[model samples]
Target: MITPAGTTAVGVDVGTTGVKAVLLDEAGRVVADAAEEYPARYVEPDGAEQDPEDWWAATARCVNAVLARARVRPADVCGVGISSQAPSVVVVDRAGSPVRPALLWLDRRGRRACEDRADVTGRVLATTGNRLDAYFAAPKLAWLLAAEPAVGQTGAGVLMANGYVVSRLTGVRSCDTGHAGLTLLADLDTGAWSEQLVDLWGIPRGWLPQVEQPTTVVGRVTAEAARATGLLSGTPVVAGLVDGAAASLEAGLVQHGDVCEMTGQSTVVNAAFEASRLRRDELGTMSVLPYPVPGHHLVYGSMVSTGGILRWFRDEFGDRERQLAGLDGDVFAALDELAGTAPLGSRGLVLLPYFLGERSPVWDPAARGALVGLSMASRRADVVRAILEGTAYGLAHNLEELGRLGLAPRVLRSVGGGARGRTWNQIKADVTGLPVETPEDARGAPVGAALVAAAGVGLIDDLAATVRTRQGVVRRVLPDADRHAAYQRYYSVYRELYPALRRTYDALATLRAELAP
Candidate 1:
């Protein structure tokens, strides 16, 4: 394939809810974008899995749609990049077929496996810069080896979701440093897989893929991939970072003291700092990993179910909103309007948005969602408002933790689906008592992936320079003093809910497991 002088780059983001592909021009403007949804199977209360093949199919569909929509020829695509949900375990055979369903980052079936190795907890944390938890891929891989030994025996290689797509695209099995850091198998200091950690978990070192920099050109789109996805054969494929890091890049968080709040299926609050400022105590609760930009690291806290909680409410309780949506109206907009009708603090109602347990600040896998202070006067809209406020409180909780580490944001750059809601953005601003900035382009991760692809192909000289030139804040929401004062009262109560119910949460988890078939 001959590349044109005016060629573009394609960035594909495989998220928890769907796959989004964006095509960007030389000037970093989005020429076209498309998205396709897929299902995450919840086999059990604490288990979440997805078919690797479904992700590949969604990627192909999204890429083809974006290319066709842009009216660009295959030869006009200069490079391709991918960003995806990380720490997801996909074990593949020698022929690249998945031996079993990929365990999602939210899957907690491996909690026992993670806890059984408590003896090496400090060593693992020191080596990987991540604590021992079911969230990391190593624990899930260990669980699979124990529960499904046959699959492990047949597994010739292990890859993250983005690596799986990269292998299908170019027949190269490789992972980026940002994604590798999440696996708990990589040495944070050396940026490579650790032999001691691998041996400690009893994982064959051969099962892991090679680690590469986020912008490195790992391979080219092969003939088969071209036919399936409509991308040009031999187009350069860059190793991409995880979705949160990519979104952070797009939010221009390379500079110190700049924080990004990515509100998607999950809300990730990340602050960047020079590598010299890394501390061990903070790593016990949050993740401290390498950023795509060299010499900088990202310290982030993730809430596993922020936006997913709203989706749960919309599906289970918002029947009228769904019917309105069927009539060519926006359901989320309607829900937002309903939430707007409620008073601040939802008239004494408070909700815990831990629908899928939680990740940051509170790493308890056994935690569950709860709605407190409900009364007969409470209406559905109040519940809706409580959900939104609850999520904001969670964001504020993460921000407080970051503040303790002296990495708090003076101004939070908000990006992702939740940023689109004016009411919700204002709620976040009020709850966090910080100014919230939203970029002109809400397609956060995909835009960042495209920027990385452009840099990888030599179209852009520097990632930070390109971001500064191309990205701009279109809107800013400042904190309302009155509203912030009111939210602070509820926020105090919100902070107490989890600690008050810790023992109850554990007991309920035990009772539920005992009653399960």
Candidate 2:
């Protein structure tokens, strides 16, 4: 197929920490990108919220900056796509203004609501291919209905993050199929809203948005959105996938047995498979949802604290590194250099990175972080290296569980901020004894959105073929035989720490709750 001339697409990703916008040309190369940050309010112990207006403002600023920086004309941008964090609750009134701050996917305020539906757990699992947990949308909506009864009575609809953004841009209410799966309210078999589940939750059918495929052009930019984002009015807008699925698509994990590992605030590993291959009962804590590609599904697992643990260390213990960063030096680079000096196994020290409990494989909410084999001879670098190695161990554990379910991935394509660090990717490869591949553009979710936009506007014919041709791997990390052998011994011991200390974690949690003032 001959390539279209003078074509470009804009992709905006609304993430937990910030919003990122990327401009991609016909060949899927990033022309320019910009990011804007916003605060996530954590007023209550288990609450996390963000202003929907803030996301809209950031999206505008990011998109404008990308176009200006790249010197691209608005007319050249033929299409726009949006991807965002999923399962969030963004209540909008009739005029499309937010009724309340969005409840983030990380918020746990809906735990009670999730627990109230325990009787139908089996049916929910079978119908939705997901567990009934606070992480899903139904529980969050239930919490909103009880906490803010006025909004429920009068609101126009409750949408996910990307859905809300799309509404603001085009005056349309719709969500992609991939994100609808996160609601625990969509029927996997029929690929639509489940009236039974929605009625059971007591939420009005009007509250849910219309569901559409990922590449569908749901609407065009309104004059207001055009003025705010510096894009031409009437530009096509595609209904994009959830953030994780977009990353998977951009990483070229479109076929069965293809896998992608996203390492950012958390570690999410997704493997693609045919829809018929989904075995609901065997997927313990792993979510099986529809992939962007038709007739395929994504089986995935997550660890709540992967790069989050490393960030905690950098904030609390890396004072010297922070000072260096203030002087135009990179703190992570300094830490990486220091960790490289440490020997294998960090001199027998092992660190468990469960600072926020865990989600997959171990699925223990009471699990806590631990530092074992600490000695006077151990230097700060040993602790740093141990943190990196510990996260790799956790990844290996989840991979083992996926293997048991007959979804083992042959090679893991790595993406996210961690993929930029060669040392970390190499360490993960060594610990898991699997080859790791990094794409030329590690920030792939937004790029994937742009690709979806291209396909939506008929600029690209075949999605999978376009991805394979355009997105190339920049680097490959292969596990060293000797290092892999050594890691096996340490990983064996690492696997035992959680089981051995489960009782202790429970005791500490109980005491803390009992002693609350």
Candidate 3:
């Protein structure tokens, strides 16, 4: 049912490849939606960047599109919540205009700086639940400081996508705990930027944006921004989360022992807890975020690759199927048919699924993927099935390690592109020996952003209640006893393959670089 006017909220997700906006009423149903794609520039061989202007342009397009589609007046949007890809480093000048291209999260060009400053990073992650790798923002920021002397003169401070847009909207520069965690500047326990880290990285503390809770009202939209994006000038903009945390909220995994696993080009498993502090051990990773309420914390354990591996197969081996799927038919149906032809365990073939270096539990980037037990008799179907099972095994391994730390959960909620495929969902259930549930919308980040905005505007008391209203959207996939048993044998082998192939991966890395020229 269409909602009565003037009680709706809008969620904006500024992701890596595109920007997505969703409009929802007080009842949590989506009333309008729009998406706008942008480009990520590979400025160097291993570097990725995007113009901060592109993000704002995309945001304007999405906001305008959503309001036009919903036929709602500017006054109807009670509040707007923003979520964006984490770890993006944007340097803005005193005038709040970007001084350089934004350094994206996927850019690996800063690896040397990240490694050379490992000690600084280690101390930071000890409090933030992330390490000094190319994934976080500080190293990328440091790289910019060294590479662009112009940055030192023109740059005023480092702000992420959320803060960048917030500045554009309100003329007040700020970010929430979620994006702060990605910066490796915030102490996870205190949820404040650390002076010790600032000294360690030798960056000016004055440049950092003030941190706020996710649902706290940052500021009202500026008249100029309102004119540019069609939002009411006085509309309230709330502090929002990183995309993964927003997805967890949309999946309703906001309580202790609740887990949300997102499978996109990457897979990230986030677990929430009410603890004031988490142990600083290295078994897995943790990040502090607003606990669906004030004074709460959430931690995340992530894997670098999940569906990305499967996507490689679909593109390489499913050319004919893709052409057929172009006609609006199910492309995955063809893939599923191929997987079905192969037996459980892929006839002893196993895949490691570490195309990108792994995160959490293992915490080793030197780790690489492998396919074992290949033979002349092995067919394409067998290889395809092995990759699918390999990804499931990776998740199972991550969950198992999470269990060792006393972080096990009863239910696993799935959301993201990979969760929609029945065969993939079934493989996850069978491999993990756990029931998997998916939300009706399955568009987790945007939904979560809307809920956060509603909570901020007093439409919902808390995140848990907001999530409860949408529980009916979830459908559970139960474990299959026989399939679980077969996967058990395969998983044992899968776990062993990584350690066994570590030496091979190191040599292969060397070989790959040597052959590059």
Candidate 4:
């Protein structure tokens, strides 16, 4: 129900691979939605970059499309919300023009900065409640400052992906707590930037953007932006959230121990908790961030390259499925259906879904993807099934880490594009031995953003109250005891595979470096 009735909100997500826009009405139903895919530039094997301008262009196109399809005038839309991939380093000059391509969340160029701070890992852990990883913004910001130098242009700005787009749309530069915590800049305890951490990185303190609460309406759409995108010139726009937090909110993770896993480019299993009740290192394998919801914190066990692995497989090996797929066909579902005939346990096959190395629990950038137990009799279906089961193992690996911390979830809510895969969802359930609930519409973050927008502009009273009353629209997948029990053997092997091949991964890394021209 709309608090005032008859109002709508628009939400946009600036994702790593695409831009998605959704128009939602009062009943929490999507009136219209559209998406546009954009590619990331991989100039170096370990480096990833993207033109921030491309994100804005795509976003404007999507917003216009969404508005046109919904047939809603700009004046009637209540507010606008945006969420984006977290902790990316997007440097802009005084004018907010792109100084260089944004260093994406996937970029590993800052790993050296992490290694450079090896002596202070404990301090960083204490300060940010998170280990130093290249995935965070501050380290990459340091790399950009040093490597590009222009990023340090006295009045230049450093922001995340969402902040950059938001600035383009509303001319406000701000970040929320979720992305702030990962920056290795925000003191998780104080919920603000720490001077010590800034000194630790030798970063100029002035470059960081202001941090605000997720639902704070930071600005209104400017006339310039309204012309570029089909938004009202004065529509309210909130500070927005990191995609994971928004996805978690949309998945019904309202209470403590409400576990949810977002299966997108990566699979991050999140569990909420009270920050005061937990010690700094209690979540060592995961990072703790201040939740968008008040008085709560989120622990994230991020598994790198989960869904990306499936996309890679689809592009490289699923030619038949793609060819047979009709208009707007979902290649993932088609591929999963092909695997239906494959035996459970994939007939003694194992796949390590670490094609782009790994994160969380392992923290091994040199880790390699591997397929074992293949034979002449092995078919494409077996390999596809192995891929699904392998990603499930990764998810289970994360759940195991959470379990050790006394935050084991009773059930897992799957959210994001990858959560729509029935075979994959079931496989994850069986492997993790947890009941999984997949939403009828797995695209989550955008909706959460819209909900936050509704709350920010006073269209809804009490955000938590509205979510607590969210309609129960989900497809529950229960784990079969037999399947869960039988998957234990392969799960054990998956756990051991990485350690056994560590030396090989190291050797391969050395050889690749040596062979580089």
Candidate 5:
């Protein structure tokens, strides 16, 4: 193995549900890792918030654990890199104290505002290749400014999770292009904050963090941050990409002709091109990021829920799995086995996996999950299989929408826990009619963050070169033509269910609200 010179760095991922610090060598080998979970508080159905303090505390705990487990001198770790859920709207006072809970990416409280402000959708997208969806920070910031009077009146707005972390570490607020692009704030052409959008959203541009390149060294660890986390003062911190973008780089999909499907709490598809391939509406949005090389851009579309649908099932139906597990089989394995036995299309059972509304294609939060075609003969296996296949069909739907933009990916690089399930991987391949590839190192986002740190400190020349040299391809799952044919029929039905039942879903939401505690 060709080892990198003076190899050790920590990549911290501030995710939706947790914060993890992965320690790696410059060659991208994992040394030690630590993670801490924090709550994503949902005060109401559409609301999501987290304390910036929780993130800093979790980050500190995870980093210290990594260092202790690795038993290496702090000096040996040359640099640090960060990756996080993007486009959060956080407010902090002058002393770097959070004025209010950070409104997270999962937050949908701003959807109404986004829908009402037509100018944000078109004007922002024209410059940034994005939409005025609640997923971005602009509308969330507006919601925050209106909801929290004190924070709005006196504090500055930080663009994302990493920006809050940066301010804590350096006592200066900052964000990078990948994160800024998600905020509906950055001008895709100029790579600067959009003044017109800022004015329209009623956000003061000064409240926005200073923008930097993904690899730009922001600042050293301040003494306060150093004490909280066992790190050497003056350590270089790289401006990191958003979690999905970093994961794409780790999966070796940075060059044109490569596509990455990051399946986590949500599913995101990012494709690299020589230049921007701008498209609007039905196809989704475009955004710019610093490529492993200069002057390259990444285009992507995102869905609000994917594996999350499975997680919902696992948590809700865990008792079913547990009952089976008592018989000496692993729960997920048993569920996989049962789902495998069910027919490709789940015996006429079709599911729309939009438990938390929808993202991508429809971009409607009011959308709800539906299980159509139930019968007296239906079994648990059929229900489980329908859920799995339904999520795959949703992915296929996203692909079809991307087709409107004229992007036909030859193959998709799959990352995260979803890729580990053999049956799930095959379902995606067959449903999407595209081969799915996995990386040898499966924990992608963290690995990508570490590689960026290595590149940041000169251990590697750039991210793409680092990924190609270090990351290995595991295997490819080819689409089953026969399975594809069957799914095509079922998918046609699945597509219609959402439109046919949208009004019913809306009514159900109102009823649930009326019955809530």
Candidate 6:
């Protein structure tokens, strides 16, 4: 139980599928935490979206629940920080209500916009340090501007998930620099939005929210927000970061060469590196974004389906296990235990984890998931174990891409829901041939947001120094040499399957699109 005497800060993360909030004490301990889930609407075959109001509502519930569970005085909460999945974006009206559901990162509808505006590709890539892909905010924003009838240019403002929530909390619109860097609009070198790119999108300067450093205090919680969220009316609210960057901080990414793997519904592998040291051309494959700490950056590769695949399998196949876990109990533990019994390589079964297309290295928006080497003898355990191995193989593939660029991280510090799966973590360790370390608090981004709040309110000096001090690597899974060798051989086969089946994936997408009622 949290005692009232000590000062506490609140951290909130509005993730793609849920919101998690943590009560963090001054010493960097997560005293209490709460989470609430909301769903994303699969708009069509290749589209995924969520109501911005759901994000705010889920965030409010989580914050209030955390405070209530801790029984802490609202005044004792020194500050609040927030993080969210990005560069997912939503347009809002003057009253801060969503014009439509947010275009989540999983949405692939922006591919049409990207193809239509190919002329700006070169400048966009150079300016943003990322490709003009459907997976990013600008293309999605452009698509929405053209497709969303309610999103009028005169009244709508583009905001990332966190920006919308920040507006509701403080009645002030703000975008964190960390998210801005990936919008395909921000000039990475200048650390600000590129007017040229925004002009290319035909979006007015006024339509974009002002971007601030993640630790900068943008505003105080308004009385109205206080009533809704249980925060002090005047509590400081910092401009928060992308969830991946925040998770990096929680994983103890303090310096250049430090790496973190945020293994949530999706997986984002980040390797911290000084921008000055690496040239743009050298890091072309992955999305490069400014790290939460100013003057720092990370090269990130996002795998769209990692833990989500397991969740999909559990929802579709693990019915008995799910029922046995009961209400509010995790079915993943039982699923993991079942998968653990399967041998390494899952008896030659391989899975393509591109259920939502893919990003980083592959960059194929039409790519779909597949299961290979399946025979009549295949068991449910093999399929479950294969899912874990498949994600690990994808991570290995990403590491190989990083290896090409000379940033194969030595020790991967992991944080997220998937990092808790012993079977999955072990598979990641063995497949990547890197020791996988997980922090004590698996609720990473929220704690990282709390640290950001603590930093904004002067509770800590030097975000990097504070992160270094609060370093917590509770468990480390090292690779088994024999299993690693066997997996590498299987991974080579996994690599071949994608290229061989690339044409079929496109054909499948076309057929599915045509047949949809």
Give the number of the best model, judged by lDDT.
1
Q: What is the number of residue pairs that collide in model 2? A: 0
Each prediction's total of clashing residue pairs, residues at least 3 apart in sequence or on different chains, is: 0, 0, 0, 0, 0, 0
lDDT of 1 at 136: 90
lDDT for each residue of candidate 4 in 240-327, tens digit (9 for 90 to 100)? 8888888887887777788999987788898877766778877768878888777789888988888888888887887899888966
TM-score of each: 0.97, 0.93, 0.88, 0.96, 0.91, 0.96
lDDT comparison, 1 vs 5, better candidate: 1
Write model 5 residue lDDT over 1-517, tens digit each, in one string. 1222356988888887678788887668889988776777776567788888888889888889999999987778777888888766678877778887888887888876787797445676677777778878888888877777777767855657877776677676788878887777678666688887778888877787778887777877888888888888877777877888778877787567577788777787777755554443433544445454455677676777777777667668768787878865556666767788888777789998887777776777777788888999888888888877988888887777566667788887898657777788898899889998887657767777777778877877767777776656577999989988988888899888888998898888777667766
lDDT (Cα, tens digit) per residue for candidate 6, span 1-517: 1122237889999988799999988788888999887888876578898888898998889999999998998998988899998878888778877777788989888788889888877777778888878888888877777886557644568888888899999999998888898788888887788888888876768888888988888988999999999988988889998899899998888677788889878999888878787667667667788887666787888899888888888878989888889987789998998899999888889999998888976999778888998998889999999999988888888877777777757788889888888998899988988898887667878888989888888877678887887774479899899988988899999999889989998998898789877
Cα deviation at 65, candidate 1, in Å, is: 1.1
- Candidate 1 lDDT tens digits, 415-450: 877888888989999999999998887787988888
Q: Give per-model CA RMSD.
A: 1.7, 2.6, 3.5, 2.0, 3.4, 2.5
Sorted on TM-score, best first, the list reads: 1, 6, 4, 2, 5, 3
Q: Which stretches of candidate 1 lie over 4 Å from their true place?
A: 1-6, 327-329
Error of 1 at 362 (Å): 1.0
Candidate 1 vs. true structure, TM-score: 0.97
Candidate 6: clashing pairs of residues: none
Off by over 4 Å in 3: 1-5, 36-46, 118-122, 282-290, 311-318, 327-342, 373-384, 508-517
Worst 10 residues of 5 by lDDT: 278-287
Residue lDDT tens for model 3, 404-451: 667877779998667777777888899988999998767767777878
Ranked by TM-score, the better of candidates 3 and 4 is 4
